[model samples]
Target: MKRLFLVLALLSAGIGFYSCTPEPHFDNVPVITFESISKNTKLDGFGNKTDSLVIAVKFQDGDGDLGVSSTLKEDSLLYKTTYNYQVRTFRQVKGAPVEISQTISNSGNFPRLRDDNKIGPIEGTLSRAILIYPGTVPKNDTLSFKIKIMDRARNVSNEISTTQVVVNQ
Candidate 1:
């Protein structure tokens, strides 16, 4: 009987491939940090009169959104995902560019792990340091940076860096 019709066609193709397999989703991602940036070491820290730049960050979420990236180097700084999610942005490598303002979802009265050290009020969040007085920059140039985090069904986190600002000329 052709081996019982080949075992009933291999159990009807394994029950239609396990009933069209599909099911796997759990959103919860957001954690970022970079608590410092007031650089203006004598107008050579790469700047352009950035209205007093300042950037310091810290985030840990269960919904999604945090980001920063870099390539502005004169010394060293880089990181853009080993894994984690939602939104991340940060850039610099030649002249001017720094604008970070992000807050995505999460009003569950977060911050309960000993307040995770600090920086957590939850009102559009806050943590940054930046000061760009772009008037002088030249010395082994190579700058790059990135910091990102995301959740709220966007899930993304993993990108933290700071390096390549060795302009001690």
Candidate 2:
């Protein structure tokens, strides 16, 4: 009985110590890290044969205000400039990489991560699919992408780049 009581006491003390641990501290500005990019290509649509790739990134924000509500309305000018996530594409040309013309808008908003009014740090991974349609670039082009995220406060996160990948393969 004494041995069982001692074990129980030790378990309770461990639980109490864990419960007293504080949350991790993070900066107010968002920070993002490149997680991965899908190597295998998938069909963009049911019937369409165009290839698509997915890029994933992990992000952390101290204030937990990292996304926007779909119902929120704003001026067209403001809306155009406000994007929760931005992705820039680069293609290998000769021996160097060049930024492609901004014909496709890969930047867009993400749903609010936290719904409650309570402010706290939050972190999560975000993945986005990019289409590699015909005529966009030469077939089997070597490409890489730069990604960044913005919090609801318009604080931009550090940019990160993904490994080079062959598209339309």
Candidate 3:
């Protein structure tokens, strides 16, 4: 009788353990979108140098909730994450083949959304790439660029390549 009772108790415990469901992993990979790119045409028109290219990115996907970090004073449960951005540029030189050249990196952290959190578009910007090439292109020259985004969990989005643009001097 005692052995039978022990067997029933073990079966009950196993059932209870199996019934418990673990919390879902909140670490979600964010989506990356390249909004627009504008170059300094005025400089290109003249013999003057083309300063830099402006690249913008728009992050999406949070059921209408923005991310905000919580501290000792305020605490809430939401999908919190960080963002990483990478930009690379290549100059199409005449004889030399296109080389994987200039690169820039930046990062930002956005905690879970809260009542007081206020931000726009889930977007961020970077523009430190001023002069891609030291010398100016005598004729219309084309250059290539790539954009990449990563989430807090180290998930990287697919690399995006843009159409080659010719810079006329």
Q: Give me the candidate number with maximum TM-score.
A: 2
Residue-wise C-alpha lDDT for candidate 2, range 1-169, written one tens digit per residue: 9999999999999999988968878898999999999865545546545767889999889989878855666556656777888888899999788988667777887878888966999888998888777678888789999999988788999999999998766
lDDT tens readout by residue for model 1, 94-155: 46545344342111112123323333223234443333334333333333346564432345
| Model 2 TM-score relative to the real fold | 0.85
Give the Cα error of residue 31 in candidate 2, in Å: 0.5
User: What are the Cα lDDT values of the candidates?
Assistant: 0.40, 0.84, 0.51
Screening candidate 2 with a backbone cut-off below 3 angstroms (N, C-alpha, C), the clashing residue pairs are none
Off by over 4 Å in 2: 1-11, 39-48
Quote each prediction's TM-score. 0.26, 0.85, 0.46
Select the stronger candidate by lDDT from 1 and 3.
3
Stretch of 10 with least lDDT, candidate 2: 40-49
| TM-score, prediction 3 | 0.46
Model 1 Cα shift for residue 50 (angstroms): 20
